[model samples]
Target: MNISENELKMMVLKACRGIGLPVAQAQEVAAAMAASPWALKQLLTQLAKPILTASFDFSIGLDIKNAHILRDFWACADAAYLASPRVCIRGVSSCDVTEALARYRGVSVVAQGEDLLVMVDERPMLKPARCEVAPDEWQQLETYAALTYVPETDASRLVGAGAGLTDND
Candidate 1:
């Protein structure tokens, strides 16, 4: 079906919540600046949202509400994800990542699961960045993650249980 930008966001968010991401995170993705693709393209950047999901083992990505990549944006996104599995956490260094996230605009930090959610704003709804978290949250990403979406599972209570928790996630 031809879904609108907002509809697409809702779909992905639903998927995120329904299926659950590998890393711990919320479902809220960056919204379109305007209701139209042109406005979304004009306002947001190519890699606008860098979400760090906590539900999938590998990673997943989706298109921005309306931003259309003239070229093979899929390839570009694939390459980007391939370049780094955990860029927000592994490549950038957790300290740097968190610091950068706090400073970055349109980048929301939310505490959905046991991880931090990092979605790019204005575009690239998918390919979110998830980080290690539990006792503390990714101040920036977690805040957004918490705001974006919520899953339908016991993962929240089951995550990072170690001996204390079970392997429901």
Candidate 2:
């Protein structure tokens, strides 16, 4: 289905949050996906895998080993953008998503062998107003996002959900 950029961002943010990512990181992923909607599939794939955290050493340049794209990529990109001009990221397979994220964050990323080299750049990213997502992917994303909601129950309805006993307005 076709969705607006903002819709895509909010959905992605909710899905990431539902999958246990912190608010800041979920926002980062959401913005990246909105900037490059084609990366939504990659985001879904990454969410299914276990989250792997990588330590970054910015002594010479940012060196991140075994960085999972969903959990570690945006953090790496932020660090690389702020502290160092270059970053060496290894053990991530989503190069296209990495490149798209770099573009969104105004950085440059290149895949060499099995590593991604990220460098700060001044290029601006172009975002489309609407994104076309496959139905299956949308369903998967919705499944993840639904985890954030409170299930409807009779107790909830009695408390505040629907019309109360005195429905005279």
Candidate 3:
């Protein structure tokens, strides 16, 4: 429960890699944390409310048969996008779950084939959100699954540009 400041920074760095954050961007965030860990932590704590939620349509076919794996994979992709509001892609196939699920989230697919693509929002640091749903939610929806995405409540700690910044920025 009580992670040392150094540990927290390392955890953030690891998470950045997990979500495929560009090296430079990841370093920038890590540096900011190293400079002012308390500032970032307070910012995160403040933004911890009024969670964002999204539902998706997963009617597309999948080669993977394990529902749990499939669910976790989809959740990771969705969380990546929600966390960054950018095109977070996974899988190699042109038409894999990554593309199908992204479309369900109402985000535009900038490119596809070999790997799914989405335009990076480059907006100021959005917190990664937790995706949750009841056990029978997927079954009840019949190919459609509703996930509640609650972003990190703190806004001040968030790094990155706000919607005002363009990808070029």
Candidate 4:
């Protein structure tokens, strides 16, 4: 696709603003696009993929379900997600899912598609990753679900001090 510099710049700015990012963050994103259009394009594409796949945490237990939310969740999961692996969580209330499924292991859940996916070492993370803030305003949740997580991934590294989880088993 032929992406004009101005078009990319506008798209980046619009996306940042639409996501409710602060002025500084929006400007930083815009600057990045202006300075390196190619890199910015790649990042933009990555950001958009969140709508394709996602993993969801039931802790919050959203009262109402929205179709858009489902779409975003899957986008976050990247389609390849299967919610395959899972980690056991203690103190978490029971739900419809199997109980013996609980193992209190490394990661707690894995799904093919959902927004806000997490992974470590490119491996599907079984643990639910929670954040005080959702990176994208489009999704309203403090936690994320996905097929995998990468410890080295930029987002994975930002978890606060001692936010790490250990198997309770």
Q: For this target, which candidate reaches the highest TM-score against the unseen true structure?
A: 2
Question: CA lDDT of each candidate?
Answer: 0.31, 0.79, 0.36, 0.33
TM-score of every prediction relative to native: 0.22, 0.86, 0.23, 0.26
How far in Å is the alpha carbon of 7 misplaced in model 3?
0.9
What local lDDT score does residue 120 receive in model 4, on the 0 to 100 scale?
21
Kindly report which residue stretches of model 4 are placed more than 4 angstroms away from their true locations once superposed: 45-169
Model 1, span 88-123: residue lDDT tens: 212221222232322222333333333333433343
lDDT of 3 by residue, 1-169 (tens): 3445455445444433434444444444444444334334332322222222223433432222212212233443444455444332334333332333333343334445543444323334323222232333213222211122134545643553265434674
Candidate 1, position 14, lDDT:
38
Error (Å) of candidate 3 at residue 40 is 3.6
Decoy 4 TM-score against native: 0.26
Q: Give the distance in Å from residue 60's predicted Cα in candidate 2 to where it truly belongs.
A: 1.8
Q: What's the true lDDT of residue 167 in model 1?
A: 50
Better-scoring candidate (TM-score), 2 or 3: 2
Candidate 4 lDDT (Cα, 0 to 1): 0.33
